[model samples]
Target: MQQPEPLIPLAVPPDWQDAGSAILGGDGVRRVLVLGAPDAGKSSFCRLVLQQASRRGRPASLLDVDLGQKQLGPPACVTLGLADAAGGVPGLCALSFQGSLEPLAAWPRLIPGTARLAAAAPPGLLLVNTSGLLKGAGRRLKAAKIAALRPDLLVAIGADAALEAVLADHPHIPVRRLARPAQAVRKGGNRRRRLRAEAFAAYFAPAPAWPIDLAGLRMEQAGVTPWPAPRQLVALLDGAGHDLALALVEAPDEPHRLRLRAPRVESPVAGLRWGGLWLDPGWNAHEIPRPPRA
Candidate 1:
C-alpha cells in the first residue's frame, strides 16, 4: 500500500476573484484564524491565502481583530487593502479591545456584535488575525476563548508557543505553523538583502487595526503608572475579556518591561519591542535601551 500525498503546496487565491479557494475546495464555508506573535507575518500569510483564493476564482474576507494596532486600513499605510485583496469583499469589521479604556468592561457587548457581523456575511472563507501575547496563564485563557470560536482552521506564525500549545490542548481543531518569508529566502548577499528589505517594507507599512471594542476606553500617550503595576497589569490583562499589549511599563527600581498580554494570556516582557527599543513603559525617555539579543 502507498501512503497518501501530503497537502503541501497549498493553492493561492487569485486576483479579482470572488470566494476563496478554501471555500471553493470545501463542501461548505471555511473560516480560519491566523494566529502569531507581533511581526510574525500573519497578515502577509492571510494575504497570500486570499491571493491564492482569488487565483482559484474564490472570494474571501479577512476579519481584522488586532484593534490595538490598526495594521489594516482602507487607505492602507501598506499597499494591500484587505477588501481589495478579497476582490472588494468587505473585510475586518471590528476593532481590537487593546489600549482601549475599560476594554474588559466593554467586551461582553462588543464580541457579540463582531460574531453577528461575521455570521451575517455571505458564505465563504472568513480569516481572523490575532495579536501576540506574552507567556502566562492569561495568554492561555485568551487562546482558549479564540479556540472556542471554532475556526475551521488555525494558522500560527513565528514563535507563538503559547497559542500553539493552547490550540493543541483542544485536540479537535486543525492548526498549521507558517514560516516567515524572510526565513525561507535563500541565504546569500543580494537576495537576502532584498528579502530583508521587502520584509522591512511590509513590516513598516501600516495595516488594518484589529477589530476591538473601545466604548469606554481612552487612549493615553503616557504609560500606565501607580495603579496598574507590571504585575498588576499582567493580572488585569489575565482577567480582562479583551486583548492587551504591554506597550511600555516603568518600575522605579526594576528594568523597564514592555509586556503584551492577549485577551487572557500573558507573554514575556523581554521579547516585546517598538522600533528596536525594549519598550519600557517605565522608561519615559525618548531613547530606549537595546536588548542584549539586538
Candidate 2:
C-alpha cells in the first residue's frame, strides 16, 4: 500500500486563493478569528490574510492569543499589535498568562486575555490567531471566546471537526473552513520545548538581573505554593496579569525582600507567581506542573 500524506506541511495548500477570497470577500471591516488544531497552519493563514489585506491598503490589527505557538510575542503571553507596526516584533503590549504552553492549562487566562488584548486594538478590523487546542476543553474555551468577541468571520484552517461544536453553538456567526496548508510543518514535543526556551531567552535578553522587595510588594493574585526561599523561576505581573518580567528568585537577605536575576522592567509589580518551570544559568527550561496548589 502507498503511504498516506502527512497531516501538516511546510507550505500552504495550492487552493489558498479560495481561502483568501472567502476571507476578504465583500467586507467593510473583516473581524476574523483564525483557529484550528496545533500545526494546522493557523499562523500561516493569518499572515496570508494580513498580506492580502495590506495590498488592498486595508488596515488591520492582530490579537495573538496562542501562548504556545506565538509569533506576536514571547511564549506565555498574548500580544496585541498592528499589521504594519513600525517597531520589530510588533508587540504593542502583552497580557501574562498562566506561564503554560498548552491551551487547556492556560484557558482561564486565554479567555479574559483575548478580550483584554482585543479591547486594546483600535476601532477597525481584527484577526485573532488562537491556540490549537481544538478538542474537549479546548473546544469549549475557543467557543467561549467567540461568544465574547462576536467576530464577523471565523476562518478555521483544517479538516478537523473540532471547530464544529463552536460553529453550531454560534449558528448566527459566519464561518469559513479551509484545508490545512500544504507546507505546515509539525514539530515534535522536543522541538516545541526548545522553541519555547529560545523565546524565553530572547524575551529576557535586553535587561539584566533585578531584585524586588517582597515586604513592599502588593499582589492581587499569587500561586498556591509557599513562597520560594531558594532559587526558583517566577513571572512578575501587573494587576491585569500581564508579565512585566521573568526572573530567577534567590533567597532574600532581608525578611521583606527577594532577589531576582532578570532584565530591566518598567511595569509596577502587582503580584508574583512561581513558575512551574526552572531555568538554570543557561536558560534551559523543564516543567513542574504541581508546583504550589495551596
Candidate 3:
C-alpha cells in the first residue's frame, strides 16, 4: 500500500493557551457580534476578547465586516496582529472588508459569506466585528439587518445609541458594552499613561450601573425615545453603576408605549423621564412585548 501523506501540524500562537481557557469557561457560545459607534472601541474590544481566548489556548475565528473603516487588515494601516495570531489556529479564518459599503450593503451576499467563513471556523467560537454607525436612517437599517443574523452574543462598544435603539426592538439578544482603551492614555508621561490604563482597567473589570432620572422624557416611537438632553440622564445611570443602554421615554398624553418585562417605577425626580425601565443585558428579544395585530 502507498504511504499516506503526513498531516502537517499547525503552529499555535503563543497566547492560544489563555484564549482557549476563557472559551472553555463561557457557555459554549460559538458566535459573537462586536458592535458600537466609530472609534467606540469596537476594534480594541475585539482584540481583547480574541487575545483572551488565544491566551487560554482556545482557537476562535474573527471576521471583520466594518466596511467603512477596513480596520482589520493591511496595507499596514491598522494593527491586525490579533487576527494574525488567531489565524494560526488549525480551523480559524479571518476576513476583512475591502473598504466599501457596496460589499456590505448587499445583505443577501453578506449572509452567505458569513456562513461560509463560519463553516470553516474551529468548534470553539466565531467573532464578527461590525461598523459603528450612530446616525442616519440608513445606518440604523444596516445595523438592524446585521443583528438579524442572531449571533450568540452581541457586544456594543462606546456611545452606541443606534445599536441600543435596535436592541430595544430586539431585546432578548445578549449584548455587552466595552469601554474605549484610548481613554486610558495620559497626556504627560508614560508612567501616567500606565497608571491611567490600570485605573481604567479596574473600572471596567467589574461592570457597574448608573441611575438616571427619566422624568419628563418623551417617546417618539414604540420603545424609542427622543430626550432633548440625554447626556444628563446618561451620567446619572453611569453614576448608579449601570451602563446606559437605550433610553425609553414617554411624553404625557402620548399613546406610544414601551413593553418592558418589569413594571414601571415611579420616580421622585421631578420631570423624570420614561415609562418602564430595565437594566442593560437584563432584557432580551423575548422580553419585548409584541405589537397588537390589526
Which prediction has the highest TM-score against the true structure? 2
Q: Write the per-residue lDDT of candidate 1 for residues 98-129, one digit (tens) a residue.
A: 22322232244335534644565455677776
lDDT of 3 at 148: 52
RMSD of each: 13.8, 5.9, 21.1
Which lDDT tens digits does candidate 2 get at residues 1-294? 101123224565766656765666666545788878788877677766666667666666778887775666566667777776321234345455555566677677767767877877876668888887777787788788887777888887777777676677777877877887656767798877776667666765654565677754554333334665354567777776566755667568576777776655677787777645555655556555574557
Off by over 4 Å in 1: 1-24, 74-82, 85-110, 137-141, 144-148, 183-294
Q: Candidate 3's C-alpha lDDT?
A: 0.41
TM-score of 3: 0.45
Which lDDT value does model 1 have at 180?
44
Q: Candidate 2 at residue 280, lDDT?
A: 60
Reference-based lDDT, each prediction: 0.41, 0.67, 0.41
The candidate maximizing lDDT is: 2
When summed lDDT is taken over every stretch of 10 residues in candidate 1, the lowest stretch is: 73-82
